[model samples]
Target: MRDTDLSVELCGIRLRTPFVLAAGVLGTTAALLERVARRGAGAVTAKSCSVRPRRGHPNPTVLPWEGGLINAVGLANPGAAAMVGILADARRRLAPLGVPLIASVFAEEAGGFGEVVRILEEAEPDLYEVNISCPNVAEELGMPFAADPVQAARATAAVRAATRRPVIVKLSPNVADICAVGRAVVDAGADALAAINTLGPGMLIDIRARTPVLANRMGGLSGPAVRPVAVRCVYELSRAVPVPIIGMGGVTTGEDAVEMIMAGATAVGVGSAFYQRGMGALEAMAAEMRAFMQEQGFGCVSEMRGLAHGA
Candidate 1:
């Protein structure tokens, strides 16, 4: 496996490998963030941040599906100011690991998103990911940011204008033509794209109560069930845009990671599966990927990228 090189670059940031800890899940605390870095994640994206702290939607926010998970965590966070403190501490702890940290911020509007980016720009994260696909908030008012290419472009442009740091636009799977939206963001100045921020404004129903399983009644669906769709999105967007892609959705193993890379994702994010396993899973998955690459006679992970495409 030493013959296989997993190094990859995203938005000018060099990663030891292509595995990244997805924005949600065990990414909320400094301790967890450090653990993920030590476990071998090339980079880490914090749980989505808002302008102020939120208690979230209250309990029953997540439900298990056959192959994925449904969650309406409501972008719950300690807010940007407090999040800066949290990130500072995490950075100090992770300094020795040399892992890149990508701050993930969400807002109700384009201006709000830009404000968060400008504020966090001082913290000097390796990159910033503008979360335009959060589905649990009411401010969305029936429309998701990533649902429309025009709106997505505006948001990307606003954030890009606000900061000099590399910006990654995380897209939603709830759109009709994801590639079109991706292209718009790229044209608007997105340095890269993280395709598929969960699938669906999905829901779970409780048979006994004859009611929705979540307090919010609707949540984003993730896990193995959305892998195919996520892969397809990566494939389509990679072909439509010139920017790099970070593909994620129900990736549980190294093979899953390689599949996304072949589908045109320059990197992959591990979400729900981390909840089922543990942070150590990141290292294990990387090891497995190295083994697979060696077996396939591939010298570098980037060489396998977009192999499924005609190029």
Candidate 2:
């Protein structure tokens, strides 16, 4: 019989496992999302979508680094209306796999975010991830939303009021006190918090051309290099807020996911690793997690949560 103990509950939704595909990467398309679900992710969050379609940044949007990838994909998407149709199809396909889909959405302002949330609310997504940070995008509103606690609170509160679904605020790691911002959002009614979106305003320069590697000049940093910071953010925010936390940064293995969970994340999101290992990576990681659990004699992932804190 299958080990049913891998299940985890996030934002009021039950997942078959604690593994979830982070927004962006291969999760943008319905076919790719279905492929990821079949490969064994407990849930999948679509690439961040906005009210209007965005072409995203120009080529050389992603650059490889020592332990991760720096990307300025600029939140490229076909807009919310088109995304709803795509999500509906993906949901139907995922039903057989019993994997939940969380829709990630972003907007330029509180009003815009509310409208986007309201529009997508009818799509019946398992959850809604309010992206308050996107370093690659050329918008003045994205990161600014979470730069301060008051703004973060207002934006999250607006989205919360617009939908009955769970609202998860995806934070930017570039902030000084992420916990303060996290607390604001949670108080604003966010059902959960997704910390450490990407670390940056970071840039890489080509020594030969003496120019920035990415056309956008600067992008969000993600991967193994940022894992430590991700852990700290998750740990601090988990203590400051009562909502569940989804930790993500450089998680590439079951051990990495376990670290985040132990640091206080109920679930973990994998992105750069997916690009590095492809869709099959999800299954590989899940298998590793099962083995780790069995070896440790833990029956469920919940039992492993925040063990670092002696909880």
The models' CA-based lDDT, in order, is 0.87, 0.86
Count of backbone collisions in candidate 2 = 1
In model 2, which regions exceed 4 Å deviation? Answer: 1-4, 138-142
Candidate 2 TM-score over all chains jointly? 0.96
Residues 107-201, model 1: lDDT tens digits:
77777888887777766777889899887775444577898998898889988998888899999988889988998999999999998897888
Residue 55 lDDT in model 2?
Answer: 92
Model 1, position 251: C-alpha lDDT score: 88
For model 2, the run of ten residues with the poorest summed lDDT:
135-144
Q: Residue 292 in candidate 2 has what lDDT?
A: 87
